[model samples]
Target: MGRYRETYERWKASPEAFWAEAAREIDWSKPWDRVLTLEGDLSRWFEGATCNTCWNALDRHVEGGRGEQLALIHDSAMTGKVKRFTYRELRDKVATFAGVLQRHGIGKGDRVILYMPMVPQAVVAMLACARLGAIHSVVFGGFAAKELATRIDDARPKLIVSASCGLEPGRAIAYKPLLDQAIELSEHKPEACIIVQRAELEAPLVPGRDFDWKDEMEKARAAGAAPACVPVAATDPLYVLYTSGTTGKPKGVVRDNGGHMVALKWSMKNVYGVDPGDVFWAASDVGWVVGHSYIVYGPLLHGCTTILFEGKPVGTPDAGTYWRVIADHGVKALFTAPTAFRAIKKEDPAAELVKKYDLSKFELLFLAGERGDPDTIQWAERALGVPVIDHWWQTESGWPMVANPMGLERLPVKYGSPTVAMPGYEIQVVDEAAKPVPANTTGAIVVKLPLPPGCLPTLWHNDEGFRNSYLADYPGYYKTADAGYLDEDGYLYVMSRTDDIINVAGHRLSTGGMEEVLAGHPDVAECAVIGVADALKGQVPVGFLVVNKGVNRPAEEIAKEAVALVRDKIGPVAAFKTALVVQRLPKTRSGKILRGTMRKIADGEAWSMPATIDDPVILEEIGEALSDAGYGRKG
Candidate 1:
């Protein structure tokens, strides 16, 4: 809190000064002629500065005698194996992997798709691309064959890497088999499909198409090339991260090489308060941008000890597994989703034994996946004896926009507000006409000007798509489809997506708020709310809940209980019309509940899924539940 308090005051007092100070951390080929010059839509930061971010991240730090320091702490739950690497060790590993890529004909600007899980080899592949100046696109490990094929078609990488399957919590989804299926469909099968054997639960590697990962690594070591950092421009494409396909097929958000590095490093330091020697863990799959930015880029660039686990936070081992790992590792600062937090908090709090370890070493607890409810924030504070700092950002933003800046914005355990925009960001809540809405009024959230380092330059292979998605709807600003407001204190309180907001009897409601309340129920495992159209009023909220195993009750009874909880917690205006209890919520491949899809089902419309959802069958069950509840029954 002390660090964050100082940063918040300093940044708020003079943002330009705050950002200028942070910019000095970047390895600039030449100092900026101006820190930033804003004229029209062109807001250039550190104009004239040039340098490869890879140099700063991998080379410069090691060259200066941090070589032997631990850089990554990678583990695989499926295999019960762990690999620890130092900066010096990684320097060589990256070289070896880069050499293997060269042997496979991967080179500068060549797209390489990595569809592997959060194993050490995955990070090796990422750094290998950095070493060779190749563009790497990481498909989330959970993606099905069709989704994998879609991204493969879009990127057309020279090489693809995967294990036979992906393991999360209780199940192992066969990744190599899925990749094989994708390759069968793809006209352009990557020239070489590399296989890594992580979970020995799978069969032996395919003979011709697959090579043993250890053998490949050994071969690269036998024929070594001097590891050279890729000479990339600040504007060069660093990564192409696909967002959760909310509107249509997933759009690849292209983040620039240097800018992304700069933004991530700064945000990790200032926003998340990541510190050297700290064990950082963000429990998100590699497919989503948060997973890419926090789980991989920012923490690695900052040289923090990052934990990359290949299984679910709550896997077959149970919900207590995460807390046990935290206790075992003595992790100082942990970043995770509010959805996960709510679930973990529901578990026998007595079983979440932070006291088993000396948890006093920890100071920061970060939450994302919608601004957490106040109860969640307070609950975390009480349970962890640490403040639960919430954050809000999108795939296009590259890094966090509104965050409880570490060494800066520390607040009491209140929910809803993410935080004020960090230094160099111009955030506003505007009405439909693009006029700035009055403070405390919910409106369209937008970024008014050019941002700090790490913003996505464009969408992968889609210039018009980029313009249409972010810039077209709003004349000049970046429109965050989520509706939110700023209090007089200047802290921004973000809600779920605009479509997720329910206007019940003309009273506005955020689904997050209602879901948070529902989560307090012992029977609920997870829940999603959607606004169904009302003939007279406008829209009323309806909930679809996934009941926890072993907890069975009449839907009507639970529905009545849910309404009372919301009415008491957030007032009567946020009332729900119906609560359809189900076994699972409709979620995308990335685990984001598609409220828009739920909304369609609630409205009795034929469901047309966005491209991201791996499982479309859950919604059918939900619809069945809804129909049984008389959702579509005519009087």
Candidate 2:
């Protein structure tokens, strides 16, 4: 048997022993009395242990003689700036910043919200918070004031760290006004604010309430006030990441320090197949879970050089920017959302710009955040001549639940599937009644509880809410909210979110399955399949196709081909007769298609604007397209 199977079986047989061994990789100030403990439906790993996440990420590495090694590389295509920090340099900066926070009365268990751009200061601030054993919440930079206000009220942070401005391709977005507005709107006001003044646009700061980031750091340095790491309990909350909830309120998913460090550190070597000192880059913002796990903590905890990229996949200069970064940095692995590659594919269909850079050092490419259509994965595989692996996880999981374990063994690539469950996750496909479904039968995907190390233990300050949102769905499992089937070989196929399963004349169909067929079209660069209201069939699928940049065929012709493809692949039961060719699909800043909002628009229901929308104008374009196709509210 291969190592992956053996390791999985060992974990299955003795989960406690398996995790106890993994826990040893992390440096603990106090040893755990028990490796695993369960209370009601909640599971806590490494209970009774004490550790500091920042120490494991930075100080330990510095002390271990990797001090001069490159720890972080911040490359900003928006500002045309590049900055590097070694392990020692990063640790010193984080310690000094920790001192600054300490002076502001921030201590263990205190909450600090970081709303900054993809700059090194943002990373330093996060590590500094961890160094002081404080819980940090990072909201996406430039978030709407109302949304930011909601987060502020929920987290009740003592202080906020923000930047003056955030850079885009052609312009700079002033973040200070938004932060000020959020503070004005929130019921619970923070005591102080620290603003980073970027050269692109310096924001006006309020005296006595706001402090300059540079000034505080300089003061801390002048006083030689570098604080040592503060150890906290293993179950102490490390960070609270807020994900959109069904109740229209955000759910703050809480991650603990010890389990987070162990699982992520192990994943860097065993899952990503990257050794210490290798350059790793996750092209995502720190506000998201991927950024929290991989960009800041995971790579650093594993002693690897992590890259912080502040640019789009295609727009910063051209489609060649990703390749250029990878070739220049000798990045061994690149993890990003599939939407990024689709954007690049739309602009450069033939990937001719790939020839301009040397990507021989780029070993693997990982895609997540949504279902990676087989067509896109295959295209990336052929274009890059590397393994384009699709992994599946969520903001709550904090790490990959289903993935191809490249380090243990290179499993055969399976299109439309993330491959198999990881060591800690026991994935199962079950029906609404919580009974296991037959293999290859579509059902809800869930993980058998207690969830492995690194997964969210509870919602911040809302234990009942956590139980209702996750545990109540399936009594003995953690509801993934995703729909898919397990193959005969045990490979997990994450078809789509459970809500995307549309019922057409009593037959449930996965929109993702139809989307896969549509994405396979030669001219289709990107696509989204949403189920719209249908009086006759209850619900029907609608395909929105964005063709390649050079495609000159009539939109109607391409639409007809897409309809035919879905009909051929999924049959008439799909009720997918209508397809529209649109310029682009509306997506969030993190590249998630706003399907729920789109559905509301198509059905002509009362729907408010999404706060995280990348471009609100795209929704207007979509409504017009729907109206043109004799759907939605008609004049």
| Candidate with best lDDT | 2
Clashes of 2: 0
Listed per candidate, the RMSD to the true structure in angstroms reads 3.3, 1.0
For all candidates in order, the CA lDDT equals 0.73, 0.94
Model 1 poorest ten-residue lDDT run = 345-354
lDDT by residue (tens digit), candidate 2, 1-635 = 29999999999999999989988888999999898999999999999999999999999999999999999999999988899999999999999999999999999999999999999999999999999999999999999999999999999999999999999889999999999999999999999999999998999999999999999999988988889999999999999988952234679999999999999998998899999999999999999999999999999999999999999999889998999999988999999999999999999999899989999899999999978999899889888999998999999999999999998988998899999999999999999999999999999999999999999999999999999999998999999999999999999988889999999999989989999999999999999989999888999999999999999999999999999999998898898899999999999999999998888889999888888888999999999988988778742
Residue 476, candidate 2: C-alpha displacement in angstroms: 0.5
Backbone clashes, each candidate = 12, 0
What is the TM-score (0 to 1) of candidate 2? 0.99
How do the predictions measure up, each by TM-score?
0.90, 0.99
Clashing pairs in 2: none
